[model samples]
Target: MTHAIPVPLPSALVDHHAIDLERKYSDGWGMKVDDVATTPSGEMYTVSKIHRHTYGVDDDEADPARAHFGYSLISKIAPDGTPLATAVSGQSDLARQDTTFGGPTTGLGEDLWWARGLCVLPDGALAATGADDHTHLLTPDLTAVTAHHGMPHWREDDGPRDPFASWISTTPAGRLLCTTGEYGLYNYGDLLDNILAITDEPLTPVSKPTLRALACLEADPVKHTEADLRPGVLFAGEPVGMAHRPRPSLTEQLAKLDPTSRPGDWYNARLGRPAVVREDLFVVPVFGHIYRSGNRGGPFAFVLVTDQGEFTGQLGGMDRYLDSPFTGHALEIAADPARERIYHLNRYGLFAWTGSGDLKQRLDLEDKRFKPLRHFTLLDCTPDGDLVLTHRTQHLLLRIPCPDTLDHVGHAVENALRAYAKERTDLKKQWKPVTWHWVDNTAPVHRL
Candidate 1:
């Protein structure tokens, strides 16, 4: 009996390709790209690590007097994948902890260790939020520091006091949106308490008036007023009833979770990176525990908010996706402005949803083509509608082509042959790789 050849199906096509940014650009020590952003013209900017902290990994004890001495760089990538310029926290000596451009009003240069958030502002500036409770505004070309919005730990600083801008995003017309909270896991309950507009002009100076209007907790005329309860664990000798309060132990807190409990039901509802859908619409993901133990009910996967800081509704939770498990719990999201759709990345796969929260399509991670690009943590969409993804652990970016730009027929055949090669190992040696050729010397055409 003769075996019949499998025909190609359009559904088998994958339009994504991975790029190793770390291998291409690293300053001796292996770098890891943490967060990424894109300009209106498709230029990419990334915050990458130059050194990692050794306190937690090497030893449990942390030195109070000595600085961690970690560093990161911001790079500018042109649309064609060319490295244009790179900016670091310190300019003169890479070993020095002192900053080239940093202050109390702006932020400490050395505070950018493992920078967590990055976004493009309206005036074409770049805003990066660091893991150390500070945000820096850099020039569009990643050259100089234009401004820095530092969320200081103390309540009575010479500078303005703003919420912990843990995560940030920008509106279509130029407003700065932030996920508000205090420092550490003890204050996790306050993580998603408020998703508010922090500033109108992030590139400008962070003034006392500007932060007063954007303050996270209620201000008190009397210092250390116990009445004004706030988030944070009470540290001994620290100012009492100030910005933090005594909380349950971590062990006790973890004990509250039952199998049916949800993230919101317990205590903390940490909001992931924010994605602006339009001038009035934005979405934030509820990033639960790594194991997702308390994700069986309550808080939805993604929360929809208006530009005015109104919570409209939630989408994709365990309860709603009982039939389709992969649709729940997203980590990062990006908006395709041209298509008016949002792309969400979760453990299971990447899902596309319309502005009104309808599912458009889903790309599973288990797919052969997506397997190589599965380790990404950050996601951002370019103006031209392509996705720029950064790996969670590695210094890399995976540029996934938009569906409209993909050659449907070519992709189908290429994947079909790959599947066939796996199925018929005996004939794999005779199979040749697929390549594209110019059909008429004008437009390139792909052929099997």
Candidate 2:
């Protein structure tokens, strides 16, 4: 019996063009342009990094000198790639004790909170998590309104650990729901390493493993009163990294522990996922998984949680076929109000899942230069359904149109492959060799 060879599909989606949104500054190293918002005037505003000057006194304490470094900034850019306005933060002249260099020096540097998240309220308020558990609320014009310093415990002793990520949504009761992730003191030391160390111990089954904090705050938009919005445990368990096990045929359990064991363990633990809000659904991507709930106030549960099966299903059952185990992580999600479509950028590709939980469309551009889906650390869908995506490397902002039809490309490819196979029996006769070629050259190439 001859096995039928499967053909790959062409991505139905095409890039319109890449828009250069930020000017007058370059993206800093490891700086992520997380979120974007539109002002009342229709100008696009983005949260990015900027270089600022910090002053430090000399060894003799004679005079203070200036040093320039990177800091977080909220910038407004025009459609034509012009910077309209910018508001800088997390920079001070005070000398910082540099433990790594073992000296006190004033220098512009990155703040831990900048990596966490930022969001714009419906009433044109800019809310961002700041250093020392400080939540800074600013007007639409970027003016500071109120600052809510987290509890003393959140900022005392070892100093406030920066928030991992934050999400903003309107509750059914007409309040703002702010969700944030806080790193634990013990777990704060190289998150990936600590998690791996715990996993290595066979006797020590992890009990009461606390995650980096995932807290929700309910704040009245008008009154500005804030209260704990989360119910029960925010994130109950610690995230586990991937570990490789030797094939049972190869090694026994005792032999697996040998120092020279074949097929070493593989682990890539990720926690503190980012959150996205679409109408009544609040979605969070954590530990190579996606979880969602309804609104903010009442009881909430997972709409579509991530698992090995779902991950494999999304990749069309190739997870097992590949040599490396498949891993899926959600970077951000975009919702189009006009089309009522939600776009999710996973580690795999850009997928458009329906509001009703149906996988509608997928555009697999994993090999592109500016893999918009892969590079998106922050994403937003405009009222018109256009996507505002921020790249991790370039820190470049992108505005792309979201397709109305979900999974249109996936369906088209499936149909095309079926039709091609049915119509061309000769091609199927040499199925093995021919199918490989077709999948490799799925997109039609016009030779001039």
Candidate 3:
């Protein structure tokens, strides 16, 4: 017997033909696709937050009166965008009561919900970071979770800290590094965007045996609570005041969607909460390098880091000179190893660059060609070079087909930048930094 080779998928994605992923996998709840990652073989993995109730869900509700608690899920898809497997992480109380989620027997442990970060580890295991400062390692098959890495302290400073990791990536040498979202406070209320080394040493390249080893490892048991038996209260049993009335039921909200309703309107009506697109990091494939954005405070620039996790320099620090960090660019980057292409995503459009850092093409996704999808957050590239994107306001995954070749915009932008640089040099020659001396003339000044 012989195995048949699978036909290759199209290199570019079709805008109107995007996969309706959230509808099929959201399990009848509001969900926001947070982060996405792809395997070398083209498998797509997505992490999403599961909203249990309709709009207006609040955390101020009582314990048993659960309004909204953090819940999340992971889905694995084939190269062709077919759903293969799904693993959900949520509180035991909600999972048991809601048929949409798995119970205590589910593969993910407790408090593992609110997962916002995902990356394919060097060993091919999936590393998912969630609440309580933990990163859970699962088998490549998504069958069993092997390890729960509890981040107890900041690795760089070795200080007591708690950071919510929302972005994770791998280096070419097989090391896993993660960073939390920006605005993270460290010791003494200091804001530091700390990069965490998940693996103490570089991992061996992924092999079938190493992937299978994850399933064989023994995982810790999850402790269950007594709230498993009771259904969570979405509304207060007795009305206390006029201000705290129960919101409309899911069915009532669904009824508002008529045949003429636009999909965006329907989505907006049931919108729960928005998930922040955090700072992202990825390895530049063919070049075998790492590029990342600052976690929090910006002027955001992509910093180049070595495979061993040492800062080399800023890869896109020139943006600070050309564009204002305040209103200019909130750029997210994605790389295509198959074609050795790099992409920069910003508010206006997308810019494609070569592995050698030359502008290749520019795409404005806001154009009418990519209709109904606006405000795209650049995710990851599929193995076939399709750009994966998602609208923060919409619950759909959009893809734009990107072939190996693109219409060359030449070095016009580069030449223009050179002219800009020359003008800056002339301006700099006319100015210099000077120190100001101040003398206090007030009374009661003692000089030693």
Q: lDDT of each model, Cα atoms only?
A: 0.47, 0.35, 0.40
Best candidate, lDDT-wise?
1
* Clash pairs detected, candidate 2: 182-213, 360-406, 360-407, 361-406, 361-407
Q: What tens digits encode model 3's per-residue C-alpha lDDT throughout 237-352? A: 32111222223322122234234333332121111111111112232211101125432222233333333333333233234323322232234567665566666655544566
How does candidate 3 score on lDDT?
A: 0.40
Error of 2 at 400 (Å): 1.0
After the best TM-score superposition of candidate 2, give how far the Cα of residue 105 lies from its true spot, in angstroms.
Answer: 17
Name the runs in model 3 displaced over 4 angstroms.
1-30, 53-69, 92-111, 131-133, 152-167, 177-193, 196-298, 308-331, 356-359, 364-373, 406-448
TM-score list, all predictions:
0.61, 0.49, 0.50
RMSD of 2: 18.5
- Sorting all predicted structures by lDDT, with the top scorer first, yields 1, 3, 2
Which lDDT tens digits does candidate 2 get at residues 340-389?
45566545555666554455555565545324345444356655555665
Which one wins by lDDT: 1 or 2?
A: 1
Least lDDT summed over 10 consecutive residues: which range in candidate 1?
Answer: 8-17
